[model samples]
Target: MPPETPANFWGDMPEEEYYTSQGVKNTQSYFETPNGKLFTQSFLPLNQTVKATVYMTHGYGSDTGWLFQKICINFATWGYAVFAADLLGHGRSDGLRCYLGDMETIAGSSLSFFLHIRNSEPYKTLPAFLFGESMGGATAMLMYFQSPPDAWTGLIFSAPLFVMPENMKPSKVRLFMYGMLFGIADTWAAMPDNKMVGKAIKDPEKLKIIASNPRRYTGKPRVGTMRELARVCQYIQDSFEKVTAPFLTVHGTSDGVTCPTSSKLLYEKAASEDKCLKIYDGMYHSLIQGEPDENANLVLKDMREWIDERVERYGSKNL
Candidate 1:
């Protein structure tokens, strides 16, 4: 469903750039979707001229800026302008704290953004590609499912979540706990020690940034959010064969947060004949953020090659 005008959506806060050195240009704008809800967005222009634009979405509990700076820098360096946004309720976007329940609505915001830009003068005809990480990857795929074939030139997913690892708890105990806790309190109750995607972050610098940012890395996932995440995982598991768009997915075997199995499942089941999956041997959940320099470089190398192949075959321009 299309939203009413998103006139109420807010833009990024003042200090987003203080947290990372990637130096995003900070267009710091909001587009009015329908329903008086506004969508938060940022555009980072590449220094070099470009043939395509990349629109990126970050993972759960992560803002677009927190997760996409490195990739944006790389894409910019490679001559592709990058556009990124916080999903509703994630970064600077409007809504409750982490309250996006439906993936379709989240996806629609991008479609709105794309249409809004496509109709504008500067970006009228530029080919745009979609990129997402983790839940953001799932959001991209969900959007692709809703969009027409020309909706995007192609897609790139990093650690896409077909199924995320919930916890190390035993199934019976975990379910019982969920049932008991959910039965008594609201079903949206957040568990302890479970929201720490950044707690054990290997990078001290990144952790400091996360710690410093009050708007980020501080959301408690509701039970509804957890349930929706599970539902989307199951949906992906059941409908991978329907995903026909050419996509490249990258994941790490050692990723304990989102789990590498999800990537394996997507690779094995996705219907796209042009799909490719590259698994990093020892990387963690955030492959681009957590991997060693060489492995991260290789991962980016694979993504670059794939993008080149798509642009060459598709012959689309970056906005």
Candidate 2:
């Protein structure tokens, strides 16, 4: 079924169609990994010099397609070479849908793809940034920790799940039950009612489009996936002080999924001398895709200005 045309559609043309029409060079392929083949996408500017490279990842249950790709298209249009991969068990990637058993392995798979591109002759010298939204924000941090210092030129995060919101946190009883049943039914969908799809997005029309995404995982959070998510969020929260890369994190003040306090804590705790945090008043979790057109553009403008400044300061040195 076609997505219901929302009364509040943000773009004149559908986002994907608009991006293609704007002459962005978009490509989709799979990156071979030891565990499975990961679906990857790249968006590059057409007939323009690539100023910087952004390796990004989608939030939990989301992929590099649909509205998420709109940000990639915007980045490409602004002269960034954007690369992203669907994490294991998400989208077109080979794994159980939304079942992230071992986050380390999943993070490694994403980093491998980014490293492959970053090391290539054409992009080796470009200033590279790591971008992640929601849970992928934790994945980006994990990737940074796994890599040597200064590997990435900068980092960008949008409502990263460093700390799961209090209401969304799993109860002790649930965790105990998961522990008891994990070995036998680790893939079981444990939290069916925890769907944040409707809550995280503010616009009814945008919510309809997101819900209609063919690649989105609408099932309950798998047992192992939830466990790993808890563990990863805890790990990131504890390790915030270790971050040293220049980073800009933006969060909506009203986000109900991932707490806005997480970004605040990160800014206060992170060792990065150049780190920044922007809190959008009353915006929801989906800062760029779910907000109204004016609000989305407001966030995008901040992103563009930050990225362009970095490119101006650092890009020419590489060239």
Against the correct fold, how does model 1 do in TM-score? 0.80
lDDT of 2 at 239: 92
Displacement of residue 31 (Cα, Å) in model 2 is 0.6
- Candidate 1 overall Cα lDDT vs. reference? 0.68
Model 1 over residues 1-319: C-alpha lDDT tens digits? 8533222112243454532334445456777776225445544553545667788878877776544566766776666767776777766777666765666787787667765665566654666788988888888878777776666777898888778576822244454567676454323436444645653254655555444544564645655566567777777788888877788888887777777777777778877778888887777767676555676788899988999878778785444
TM-score of candidate 2 to 2 decimals: 0.93
List model 2 lDDT by residue over 25-105, tens digit each.
Answer: 888899999989999999999899898899999999999987898889899999999999999999899998988889999
Cα error, candidate 2, residue 222 (Å): 1.0
Q: What's model 1's lDDT at 206?
A: 51
* lDDT by candidate, in order shown: 0.68, 0.87
User: Where is model 2 more than 4 Å wrong at Cα?
Assistant: 1-19, 316-319
